[model samples]
Target chain A: MLRLADVSKRYGPGHWVLDRVDMQIPPAQSVAVLGTNGSGKSTLLRILAGVTRPTRGRVSGAPPVIGYVPDRFPAFDAMGSLAYLVHIGRMRGLRTAEARRRGQQLLERLQLVGGIRTPIRALSKGNAQKVALSQAIMVLPQLLILDEPWSGLDANAHDVLAEILDEVVRVGGSVVFTDHRESISGAYSTLAYRIEEGRVLAVERVAPRPRGVPMAHVVLADPGAECPPPSRIDWREVAGVAGVRSIDEAIHVQVHPAACDGLLMTALRGGWSVAEVRRDREAGRLGGGDSWAH
Target chain B: MGALIRYNLAAVVHGQRYVAPLLFFGIVLTVFTVNDSGPLANIYVVSASTLLVSMCWLTVTILNHEDPVRRSIQSVTAGGSSRVLVAEVVLALLIGVGLTVVGLIFPILSGSHHWDGSGLAAGVLALATCLFTGIAIGVLCSRLVVPRTGYSLLLALVVVIAVPLTPGLPPVNPALRLMSGNRPAGELLYPLSGYLVVSIVVAAGCIALTRYISVRRE
Candidate 1:
């Protein structure tokens, strides 16, 4: 088991990011860490991934092979995605030929759109995230840590990510991630906790929103003038957006009640304004109706 | 270890960060050697000095090539910060060997000189010392120590200029004074070897300190 004992982390003269905290990360489990912005979720993952040392704590039994995907994947413009993957794979202990081969396979599996030769900086943000995920899973690490892994991924890539995490647990490797969506944490994770005021608080599984009922109909504005919104191919990755129909440049979403909060959070986080939300007491179970489809 | 070195080398090379230092190397050697009939020892001093500044610049180039996010990912895979730092030092040394060879050769081609096996051997020792000294200062002034690019560059330039002028300092000042007489290569061998030893100790100490500080910074 990987574990932290009496972990307390504080920056100089600042508040304790984590105080007298302790947790166990057993193998074969998927763990989710949830917190508001600045709650130190990233710091905790960094310490657990062994990328950074805790201010005060003992961490032990960390696996021999580990993979990490940073929140913002640095898209180095100088090298292509395949070349970057190959370099990272080799650093993770794969042979040159194996690294090349494995990188090709993972990119294909992740459904990256750009050809292998495209520089990562030129690829869309979602594609770069795909590349980041590919590098980590290429060698089948004994431990996997991802920060905001679902951000920028589309619906298909979201499913692919779920399958990948399942594979990690099937091999008895542990997985940990930090995300804001409770439904995501609730759906996939065996254990989940939210950090508040430097403490990890266990989140009881919220009973799934009214079974089969389309609990909410949400209308969200298109992304602002700053950047183009994600294309349709990848639009629903955040919060399992089950159905999307465009009405006068606004997105009309009929979502399962359980995933409604996640969808709203993701939409807002993506810079889309939530214009309106209706209870939709007259609607049926989501994802089952062509009525909600464009 | 091989993978780490290759990755860093590839990053710097592809980024074109090494161009400035290599260009500096080419220009300095060309200026110091062309049309000079000086003794081999005097020419060798110039070669050694150029090698020092060039190595310092190159070492800093290689170390800071990766941004923080890329570095953290690599660190996670490499298992520790020290391994990454060691790979960087090893990469710098590999490049240093190339510089040393260039230093040993270009002078003979451009200038008149009397040289033999002893002269070649002393050239190797003197150049090796400069390589170590350059790496020491480079690591000290690199982002690992001084993070701001302007300050880092300023610190590097100041140290590179200051070290050679410090009297009796191994490999720089001592080598310059020894070469002042244009002595026979065989006569300068003993002192050059001693300077090489001191330079190695200094380089090793700097590497250790850098490794420690980098680990803590994360």
Candidate 2:
């Protein structure tokens, strides 16, 4: 378990990269650090890693052990990936022979057995990242700190990395990681937070991007009434704001994406009563115009 | 203390892989004959000093750097006290003594009875000075560079500086006497025990400062 209380950090005495970040991570849990570029996601990771100090607050609780994987894995010349993992194992207090054996096994599991002896500097981006991750998980610390753990990984490698994460969770370890793309597939997260403007905006779930083509149609009551003009419809008033296409009398009205509730309310208030509303499940199907479909 | 020692030892052994063998070879060869001592004398001094300093720096810097920059180890260090950190520093010093013994054993086995206790102690002191200095710098450098590189570079810097300083010993500079507590000053003021006292003081100071600064950064 890890608790960050009133944590805040400032680089030059003024700008706070993290301000009053209060969080609790229970044992055997996983939390993803989400944010735009410069959103303080990495800064939070650094603070957790102890590489950077927080200007204020305290991090306390269980005698936390960490398995840290840095963003850029700087490898030495002639250093094999397997050898690297073994060294980390030894660092974490494993016997030399055991370290070596585990290192070999980790490489083989990651599909890196063939490249075990290859100098780390020579591996591809994804392979190098795997080497970095292998070192992080080798020790199985109480807490695993991973910065962009999924970067440079191919599909298969991604699965391996995800499995490693699942294994950590299964073994009663806590994981805090930062990633640009969604990596947790079909796994229910214990806690999720999105960082924006140096603030962690906690979300219950980060839904997947809508699949397939987007379809939406707005139904107007009184089938014989003529459709409202484009200029008068005020498409900008919608939240999801798919453009408003022509409304065919006694038939259908086309819309891109789903219409915002506010827009629907506005339409209702404007004396346009809705008979029905249906949204397209596919993402890109609302072709050729930015208007809402009825 | 044992955990810290283990961490340091592992990092040095593994991290050395990143550094080319040519670098070590060059360092050992260069340290050997950089002085006015004859070729054999130079060989002896360089070999002992190289191994001693390498082991010392490797142990000290890696231990400090890995913990401070690595989230796993950093949490432990930050969570612990200066006392624990100081224990780690002392362990490195002990290792320094061990390396000096190794250096002495090498020459004695090769049939050089000229290995004096005072000289061996002096070498160890010099090595200790370098090792502690490397650890101190590793603590400071972690603020600037990544953990692994920060420590490796700090060790490298100490070795570079030691190349010139280790060879210049008591003969080239009078300050060496201060390090050994062998000055002509009153024995009461600077007794033989003074050397150990000074070593402990410096090592402790470095450890505390490193711990304080690193925690502040945290």
Candidate 3:
């Protein structure tokens, strides 16, 4: 178990960011820290990840190697996504062959389009988020900390991220993440720790998959010189393809993972590139642009 | 530590900010030492001082290459801010070593000055003195010690200009005095070695302070 005892954080004698907070994080469980912005959620996550040391307190029994994914991955890395993940894997104690293998596996599973070979600087927000999530998971860290992990993920990517979290817990690794609302992280986390006014309010248990059934959302490249923008939709009964709509000159199609292959193949066959494939499987959120600016 | 070193190397290479100091150092050394009959010790002194100042400028870029968000990601991945800060210094110093190599060899290859084994040894010591002194000044003015860029540049300019002007205050000053008198390498052994030790102490102090501040700041 990882524990924080009497932990406190302050910036130069100002108001407490986190005050005398005490908590225990056990393995094989997913914990979500819920708070609005500036509620000390990020500070708590940083301390748990060992990136920022608490001003005064003890963090004991932390895993030797902890993985951290910040709110947004920077858009200036020189290496492509695959290479960067491999480098991260090496630092986490994987051999070169093992690191490369695992990195490729994670990227494929996440369905990151054109992400493997493109420099991170060229990647869109949703693609960069995929890389960020993949880097942490590729290492298979026993302790994983993510800050606003869903900020830039699209519908299909969202579902994949949830599945990744479940795998982390299933493997007996702990997942600790912060989100502004319970509805955002509620579907994946097993335990909830809420932060209000720089203090841990209480611990609440979250039921598994309490959110609704997940639907796949595929966002395709904007129609332009690449492909003419479709002004109207004619195909209503394409198997697995649900609710086709146009937003910002791009087409979005909803599907379930179990029946998404046919639509994906048809899109590829039509010379249209897939910009993002994410899952829209959260409670009360569907069909919105997940690509935030880098 | 090796992995951290490798990661910093990749950033430095991508950032391409190092080329400015390196190019400036090469040009300064070439114009000052090329086709001169001045004594070898004087030539080395010019190269040494030039290198010291260039390394200071180079250090700023290396340490600040990544934005804050990227820096936090690296800190978490590498395990702590201390390791990240240490790796930045080590990488800067490693580049300084390369600059020193070019400083030592470029003049000799140009065949502009008569040289000897003792002169070469003395030149090496003088260059080492300047290298460490420059690094100390750079680390002091970096984000670790001072957060704002305007202040960092202002301090760097003041120190680079002020340190050389104050005779006997810094090793570079005394080393300059030794070469100006056309002194033999034998006469310089004790003084240059002592100055190098002092410069190294200053660098170590700066590194320790920067590491402490980085670890505690966030």
Ranked by TM-score, top first: 1, 3, 2
For model 2, residues B108-165, the per-residue Cα lDDT tens digits are 4544344455554555544444444434433444332334665556655664455337
Between the candidate structures 1 and 2, which one is better when assessed by TM-score?
A: 1
- Candidate 2 lDDT over residue span A1-294, tens digit each: 578889888875668888899887787777778777778887888777655668888876744557777776665435567766665675567787898888888777777634788877788777877787777766777887788766676545655665677678778888888865432311324566787777777765434224344546566654233755422454433433323344554223444333335456767666676777876444433433232331
True contacts kept of 2: 0.09
What's the distance in Å from true for residue B151, model 2?
A: 15
- Model 1 collision count: 0
- Each model's TM-score for chain A is 0.72, 0.67, 0.70
Where in model 2 is the C-alpha error above 4 Å? A49-51, A182-190, A206-294, B1-95, B98-190
Worst 10 residues of 1 chain A by lDDT: A285-294
Instruction: Report per-candidate DockQ.
Output: 0.54, 0.16, 0.41
**How well does each candidate superpose onto the true structure, as a TM-score?**
0.85, 0.60, 0.82
lDDT of 1 by residue, B1-218 (tens): 89889988888888898999999999999998988887877888888998899999999998898888878888888887778888999999999999999999899999887778888888888899999999999998889878799999999999999999988776677876786665788998998889899899999999888877876777
TM-score of chain B taken alone, every candidate: 0.97, 0.54, 0.95
Interface RMSD score of each model: 1.2, 5.2, 1.7
Measured with C-alpha atoms, the lDDT of residue B166 in candidate 1 is 89
Candidate with the larger lDDT of 1 and 2: 1
Name the candidate that leads on TM-score. 1
